[model samples]
Target: RKMKGMENLYTLHQEMGNILLSHVLIVRENSKLEKAMTQINDLEVRFKDVQCLDTSHWSNPAPSMIQQLHCQIQLAKIITQGALVRNEFRGAHYKPEFDLNQPKDFDPHEHVDFLEKQHYGEVQENEFPPGHLAYMKRFEECNKRWLNTTIAEYKNHRPEISFEAVNTSLVQPRPRKYD
Candidate 1:
């Protein structure tokens, strides 16, 4: 049963990754990166609720787990924000000023060029500030660990039967008699 759960977790993790990538592409394609940023900010605000534990288990999910997940989401938002900031022009994120579908003078290419010029003569040690790099690395490491754990659990628990497809089939199957 535990192994089945882990397998389910793995499948879920893969599906989620694909969905996230699609979202990123859509945002970039539509030049709605700023909109996504705003939404993420709103989510961050809502995340405050996770911190407030109700101590009730029957109605509420595990507070500690919820809090940890919330933290992971926040970390992802932070990393995304950093990437957006680093890539001045809209890269994976959309900016109203630059439309990705159409050719714009200020594209990601231009932004990369600018960044390259800005760091051309900088020493390797000074490329990224120590404090900022440390924080980013820490967030990245934690997020990776969270994702790995989630995938492991999903793979272990997912149902083998295609529940949705089976439910929608033209021929209804007889209900099973449980022992």
Candidate 2:
């Protein structure tokens, strides 16, 4: 087998790596997300165009590499779509558009106990840093709306997306503090 599409596969891998680094890293926005999604669509088309050479009775690694490339394309589609839908700055996925400003007088030590507690404990607005109470309210609202597992399935030659509730029975989910 000549392994016809290896060149295309290598190019695709490089392009995809660049796209992910530019669009899905520390800062993301709708435009970047949309561009990434569009690139993934193009990748799908290019992937389908790859002619699979017959490997019956052949002893070579080309077939294995091609299969790995297919899996990589599928994973790229799922991840890009998932990141496109999420509208929050959480963990490693930071979106500048959705980022909230830190409270001017925030004291991490004063609120560490409540922040670590399950269910967030009772809040005393007066005790909070100037803007911290407002920040917590908005954070809670987002947590209620968007805290879940993103589920993607490969069907009909595309990724069908869904969401499932996260299992936080043992330890209630708490917002990650970077500062």
Clashes of each: 17, 0
Pairs that collide in candidate 2 are none
Best by TM-score: 2
Shift in Å, residue 41, candidate 2: 1.3
True lDDT of residue 175, candidate 2 = 58
Worst 10 residues of 2 by lDDT: 110-119
Model 1 worst lDDT window (10 residues): 157-166
Q: Which stretches of candidate 1 lie over 4 Å from their true place?
A: 1-22, 25-30, 50-61, 88-179
Q: lDDT at 140 for candidate 2?
A: 64
Per-residue lDDT tens digits for candidate 2, residues 8-91, read 666776888888888867677878889988997788678765644555666856567678887887888888778888888665
lDDT of 2 at 61: 62
lDDT of 2 at 119: 49
- Please give, for residues 77-145, the per-residue lDDT of candidate 1 as tens digits: 544443344322222333444322222221223333333544685324344534433333333343333
Model 2, C-alpha of 177: deviation from truth (Å): 3.0
Q: Candidate 2 has what TM-score? A: 0.79
| Cα lDDT for residue 15, candidate 1 | 39
Native-structure RMSD, model 1: 22.1
